[model samples]
Target chain A: MDADVKQHQMKLIYDRYVRYLFIASACLMTIIILAIIIFVGQQGLRTFTEVSVSEFFFTTKWDPMEGQYGAASFIVGSLYVTLLAILLGAPLGLAGAVFMAKIAPSWLREIMRPATDLYVAIPSVVYGFVGLTIVVPFIRTQFNVSSGFGLLAAGFILAIMILPTIISISEDALRSVPRPLEEASLALGATRWQTIWKVLLPAALPGILTSIILAMARAIGETMAVQMVIGNTPQLAKSLFMPTSTLPSEIVVEMGNTPYGSAWGDSLFLMALVLLLISLGMILIIRRIAQRRLA
Target chain B: MSTGSRLISPKIQDKIATGIMWLAGMVIMGILVTFLFYMLYKGVPVLSWEFITGEPSDIRAGGGVGPQLFNSFYILTLSLLFSIPLAVGAGIYLAEYAGNNRLTDMIRLSTESLATVPSIVLGLFGMIIFVNMLGMGFSIIGGALTLMLLNLPVLVRVTEESIRTVPVHYREASLALGATKWQTIYRVVLPNALPGIMTGLTLTAGRALGETAILIFTAGTTVSRQLPDFDVTAAGETLAVHMWYVMAIGLVPDRIDIANGIGALLIITILIFNLMFTIPGKLLQRKMGSSRH
Candidate 1:
């Protein structure tokens, strides 16, 4: 009887030990986040000692060979591409979501839902390949541009890339609206178009905004596909037709050529730090919006 | 409220709005279909049995992606081998043990942030920590470690969600039957969540296979001409990287065709993996539903 009791006690201890192990694994994410922040922070900040933070932020030139490491141009380039992508993607995705949720036949939704999922699964590299072969050439020929690789190409590809995220999230937001709300809008003599524009969209604004922010974050951080089509110009873009480089693409193009721990490499880390900060802020906003929706 | 206030009648406005929505949907569907068909049309002629089995040649006209294909699977296996246990464990803890607390909140926030971190930044982190700090160099292990980190947040989230979807009553019954908590989870909960977990794993595998920016830095872009060496320290490049190299720097005339072939191969592989899990997932859901009824 005593031996049986002892064996049971050992089993309980073993169970508790395994539970702790699981808890520790769960905490690994926190540890990794902290480690990445600190490591990237340290490397990024080291560059500011050599070049003043203001200069890095304000200067437009990014000639690494000449020792000019200002990231203003890349920052602006990222903003320009992202903004254009949002302009192109948001209306299409929102309208598509509206159609899927409110107007589409059941069969159409079935087809679209899987197609959107597949779009999300399609690799960015493949998108890059398609852009290089088709979109860039088409843009060059149609628009009479000297080079097809520019902000327009990157923005156009990013717009398509972000459509899945926008459509699905906005669709969920639209679907979550109580049917009574739509019924009431229609009962008030509002036409279907008016009700959708003035009522459904306003009600779903927060969720739609969340989706937009997430898509913007994706557009800003997109590296390889943009790199392939963006023409890799280091200067501030004069127009959508002109070539430019964003922060991530700049890092990808130069990180290998630049010696590790050099001013240029550290500058790339600083850009990454900038990217991280922007994304973290966006995540926090998303979380807040989500919590608000729950409440 | 005036008659001339609106140029179009409400009926016409409704029609126009509906028309625009339909156009948007058609455009979305049209883009995806065109991309798939165009890629297949361009790539199919180049894809042959010899292309799949032959070694890649630097100067020759008919080099294949044989070694690169092997390395892609190799790195994916290594990463998944390391990631699954930790992710599953973390998932279990979050689903079953974590109460609504600050620690749980922090974990969720960290996972969210990690998910949003760009692949290139993670590659830089991997370059710093795994390759340089750990002295692993640019090798399969380093790349795998990076990929594991990249996929862990998604895996954990999916696993936690799947476990949570297993009815609470199931756990309660197991406990009432005098089963240990770990045994209850291992035997009852995990089995029920297996389909969902499998779906998540397949998606993660697809992501790992198509990843490029991360591997470019951690797994240096050198393809071993021979059959893949299992050594973790050896540099490796996957199909995505191979496509990137061929398109960007490969001066060969047939580079575009080669890239097209790789892209088609990648799309087909991903499509297969997705379908494999999704079909099983649908069947599992139906079975669970009927059993409950």
Candidate 2:
């Protein structure tokens, strides 16, 4: 009888111990989260205050050798290329997602979905090599240019690279819309196309936009592929057909040589901080959207 | 009404849309197919056993990336060894123990953002923290550590998802049998999640194998001549980095011919790994579905 009472007490103690372990584990996660954000902040902020913030944001020239390193050219180049990629990519990606979601037969979706997932796992370097061999040569021959690399080629490569992200996310978004809404629209004498444009699209707009921004963030940070195809020219190019520099290309090319007394290193850090902010903003927006949807 | 109806029938529009969709699919697939074609075209002709086995040499005579290939495997294995267990432990803790609360959400958000953080930024962190702060020279260990960090978030997410998929009834059954929580999770939950864990680890290994930029800042470029005697903690070049250096610096002009060959090999290896992860899960799903029916 005494042994049985001891066993019951032991069980109570073990239960409390398990709860303690759970709380400790939760604390560990919180600590790691703080560590990552704090580290990024420390590294990023250390460099930003070292240089003129306006010069980093506004100027067009980026001659690291001459010590005139404004990220303006890189920023413009990044935005322009990303914008071009979205213009080319989002519509096609949306169409593809919609087709797979609403139009494709079940067998086709089964085949294509796996194929798309496989596409996402292919590394950026292989994509770079692909862009180098196929896109570069095609551009050179068609445009009769001296350099095979061009912004258009980079944008096109990025568009392809981002397609899977857009497609998968948009497909999920579209899939989540209630079927009753579509049924109701159809019953109200609306055509399928009308139902799609007026009903389904409006419902999925936020998610589709989220996917777009996510893709844009991806395009901005993509390094190796864009570096290979963008010609790594530091100067801003007027035409999409011409080669230009983006923030990622600049960081990759210039980080190797710290170039003492030059703020190029600091500039690189600032660019990274900007990229981080953009990604953080994206996540916050996504969390809000997800919360509202869940609610 | 007759003219308007004839101009654009619902059937006609649907047909056109379907046709356009098919055309778009074909075009995009064409790009992917063309890429594979070009890689094969440029790569296959030059691919010989000697080319694969030889050591990389001077600018004039292109040499083999034998050393780089070995380094890649070593770095990949080491990175996976370091990351998989830590991430799995952390993941199990998250999925099984931690409640769905603000703290857990914060951890998850940080991890997701970490996933989006550019490889270059991670590379920078590695340079500062691993190379400079830790006093580790640009060596294989530093690169491996950096790669481990880079792959951690993905592994954690995958592992957590896999663990969560283990049926609740299994846990309840184990508890009912008088097992402790730890014992139940260890015996029932982990065994069930093992295949999925392997899938995640395989994908992570594939990424580590292909990584270059992070290694560029962390791993120094001195390629050791001997294979078996090679110390991984020391600086060495891997296959992907070798290819990048070959093209960018043109340090070995003759070896540039083999770049595509090396790339093709890497891509094929990664594709195989991806299939290993995805195909099994898919086949298992199909089997389950058929059995249910």
Candidate 3:
């Protein structure tokens, strides 16, 4: 009896220690996040000290070789591509979500659901390669452009890339709407189309909006695929057919070549900081909307 | 009433709406199918046993992706090795031990934010912190560490979810039988949650494999001409990076063919991983009767 009690006491101590250990492991994520923020912030802020913050952010010229380091054009390019993606993807994604949730037969759902998951699983680089070989060339030939890489090509790739996110999230949101609501609309003699637009979509509006915001976040941050198609010109895009660059793409193209402590490198870090803040804001907004829906 | 009748009937409107939705669904499916088959059709002509096993050549018309394929798996293993333990531990703490409190909320928020951070930004972070600060300079270790951060959020979320699905009675029974908390978790809870955890792991592995932006900066774009060495500090390019490099900068005569081959290979590998987890995931879900969203 005495030996058994002593073993049990030892197990209790071990459990307590392991529990704290797990907590420490959990805390590690917070530590890493803080470290990233601090390190990036420190590096990024150096750009401002070297050049005025307003000039760095507002200047359109980005020739780092001659010391022109404004990122206004990249920021605009990111927004333009992301906006185009949202315009092209959001409606189709919503319609597809509605079809899957309310209209599709079971057989079709099974096939399409797995396909969607696989779509998400495919690497972004593969998308880039496809865009580079197929879409860019096609655009060049079809439009008779000098170079095929442009905002339109990047936007098209992003549209397809974000389809899975938009579809899944919006489908989940639509599915979560109670069955009784739809039944009541039917009982009131509302048409299926009216029920969806007037009843179901409004109820799931928050979720749909959340998905849109999330998809927008993804499109803005997408680097490799966009870099492959967007001609990497650090200038304001003249038109849909013109080449442009984004913050992330610019960093990818220049980070390796730039000296570590140079103002150009610091500028890349600043771009990263900006990207980080935008995504964090989106995530927090998503959480807030989700929580409000739950409440 | 006849004169006031609308041009389009409500029934027609409903049909049109339904038709549009169906067409939208078809568009999505069509895009996916076209992407898959087009890639395969273009890539399969060049794919061969020799291509899979032979070393990449810069001068020759035909070079294999052997070094890149090996590097991909090598870095994947290294990252998983570094990430799984901490993610599992943190997951268990969140699911079992964390109560409704500010600290838990903060942790949850941090994980979500980590999940949303752009891969390119993470690439920049890795380049600065891992490559420069840690003095690991464009090596496998640096790449793996960056990927570990990227995959941890998903792994922890999956672990917590699976742990939650392990019926509370198992924990209570283990405790009632004189098992300590850790003992119950190890002997009782973890055993039952193994399938779910495995599913999470498979998914995380897939994410890590597909990652390019993070690996691009952390893992150098250059691949060893010879067979891959076991050294962690050696610079290596993954298959995805290889695909990018071949397309972006490769001046070889057969760059297009090689890029196509790499694309096809990547798609096939990803499809295999997806199927591997999904079929078993369905079976496990059915067996456990645990309906996960």
> Candidate 2 regions off by >4 Å?
A1-50, A187-192, A259-262, B1-7, B285-293
Candidates 1 and 2, the one with greater lDDT:
1
**TM match of model 2 to true structure:** 0.90
Model 3, runs deviating above 4 Å: B1-7, B290-293
Q: Candidate 1: what lDDT?
A: 0.89
As a whole number from 0 to 100, the lDDT of residue B251 in candidate 1 is 65
Clashing pairs in 2: B62-B254, B62-B255
In model 3, state the lDDT of residue B56. 87
lDDT by candidate, in order shown: 0.89, 0.76, 0.89
Displacement of residue A169 (Cα, Å) in model 1 is 1.5
- Residues A3-82 of candidate 2 have per-residue lDDT tens digits of 98898678768866765664554355445445545665676565555556787688877776786757787888888889
**lDDT string, candidate 3, A1-295, tens digits:** 9998898888889889999999999999888788878888889989987778877778898888888888999999999999999999899999999999999999999888888888777888889988998899999999999999989999999999989889998999999999999999999998888899889999999989998998999999999899999999999998998998999989888887888988988989999999999999999899989899889
- Lowest summed lDDT window (length 10), candidate 3 chain A: A48-57
